[model samples]
Target: MSGERARILVVDDEKVIRDSCTRILTTEGHIIKSAENGNIGLEVFREFHPDLVLVDLKMPGKSGMDVLEEIESIDPNVVQIVITGYATVSSAVDAMKRGAYDFIPKPFTPEEILLIVGRGLEKRRLLLESEALKVEHERIRRNMISLVSHELRAPLAATVQYLEVILGGMAGEIPSEAKEMIVRCDIRLQEMLELLRKWLNLATFDSPKMAEHFQDISLSDIATESIELMKSLAEEKKISLILETSKDLPPIKGSKVSLEEIFNNLISNAIKYNKAGGWVKVILYGREEEVWVEISDNGSGIDEEHLSRIFDEFYRVDGRRNAPIKGSGLGLSIVKKMVDAHGGMIDVESKFGEGTTFRIGFPKFFQRQKEG
Candidate 1:
């Protein structure tokens, strides 16, 4: 049995063939439109907007081949089946290549017409169902990520606060050994918090709600703010944080939070992975069409092979994974998605012993800018 009633268009120059196809298919629970000539076939096809089209291979005026070409130009996804008395392997092959789903020979039986039409419609149903499943899977995956991250956030945040008080000796007198253990626990909890936050941010990154907050933003200002926030981390490792920017970088269009996030993730990683006394440089420049920001770090550089897959979700470079680097491997993944959403470009340059640099460019567009 067919999965669903499909809207079908029958385009054959012969009245008998077109009428027979319509009678057989319409009886099989489909809405059918029949056209008597090649030119009319193309017209009806566009107006019908059918799930399947049954077109003859040869016809007068425009010819079935010409109709097929026009139909392909209109919407290639519309399933087309060819009808022809001159059935040959070469002709069938040509028809199929030109986007025909199946071929019907002359004098096809009622059963044959139904069977072939049913097969083509079934293919359409499966393709739609497969795509729906994929969308559902992604929805579930993101929902789970969001749910877990938010649920764990409160307790983890409280834990960090209380741990801080205790470590600061505000709770009471504690032994040095116990303080050391608590510090370790606190570090682990902080790491977990970072992971949860990233997960939550990633889940909401591409949401339509977030897109509403986009506005013209200062690239240099955001870069300066991110640098200030990461200064302590860089100082702890004795790493130099350098900022080089053209003061006149043109404002680019994007969610301010998203742009700031890009700065945070890239700068944070540069500092985290750098050796003591290393330097991380952030450069912001403006081209005619877009604004570009580059974050470079002279630290433990990424390997050649790892560079390609670095932006992939939850994938860690072998060096970063084996080394003491701390991350959920989702930072660059988030960065890449955000860049793509802005219709921007991102590039990476690295050599194992030298260093790594990440450059990102955002398109310049002012669409009802707001003061931020």
Candidate 2:
């Protein structure tokens, strides 16, 4: 009657009420199911899966309020209308609170009931349409990200390689001045490439697919490799890299590459922001159900105001001291996404100008768990 016919369930203790609703809705081409009480209504709901439900209060056993609450948990999308003899302001308020779209008083005219039912059906239709639009928008966004990243990656990577070749003296010995310029260009281009990669990683990440790749991995080993990879950068800034791990730690379920990226991004940031001769410490151990990794650095710690947004994409502290530090601002964002995909938790603690510590906990691998 609203737009298209919908499956409707009518639940009431009185035979006349249920028959009346079924006859009215059925004549409008809607399919109908009738239940005598709240218990029967819930049973029919699970199997019939109606798009709308008309529930009556003052039942002998299970009350309509109980039905509304249970239906909300089962499927809040289904339009719910309460039929009540009490019909007091308090009763209506209580029904709405339990997820009723509207209430029809006892002995209502056929026209009044029809009007309420029509409005409920329209509301359900709009809600469904809104949900569909949101899903579509997300799909389009993901596609656009993939297309742009793929288009830019190849050309940018080639330009960086060509610059590296020249800097390596393959193009012929160049003047010292020209060499310095090419080196700077190479560095900037590389940073752009890194940004794009991280951005693509964040946008295209598939949590379900990631879970498929999960395997028992040692966090200590991943941290060690990341430390090794970042050694030269730490050396340039004269920052000391230290690793302290408890032995015989339990394995964590995760994709090795994803886990490695988490450690690398955090460790690199620590070194980049640290003052000369500062120390970056990585500590790993096992707690009750989680394998924990803590990366702490004696550096220019983040401000209190910026901590909340530190994981936001393209967000930076913008402090004068950090002006020289270059990043895509997507590193922490990507780290957080990957950790969530692994069913892990991440937290940060910092005191401005003092230091910062990032703690991540990965669920310990168990035999019953097949995927993340």
Q: Find the candidate with the highest TM-score and give its number.
A: 2
Predicted model with the maximum lDDT: 2
lDDT for model 1 comes to 0.85
Deviation in Å, model 2, residue 77 alpha carbon: 5.5
Candidate 1 per-residue C-alpha lDDT over 140-237 given as tens digits, one digit per residue, 9 for 90 to 100: 98778856765688878988999999999998999999999999999989988988888777776653556577777888989999999999999999
Residue lDDT tens for model 2, 1-372:
276989999999999999899888888889999999889999999999988999997898999999999999998888999998988989989999989999999998879988899999999998888888999999999788967676788788988889988988999999999999999888878878888888888888887777886898988899989999999999999999999999998889889999999999999999988899899999999999989999999999999999999999888887353578877789999999998888788999999888999999888963334441
For model 2, which pairs clash?
Answer: none
- Candidate 1, clashing residue pairs? none
- Least accurate stretch of 10 residues (summed lDDT) in model 2? 363-372
Clashes within 3 Å, all models in order: 0, 0
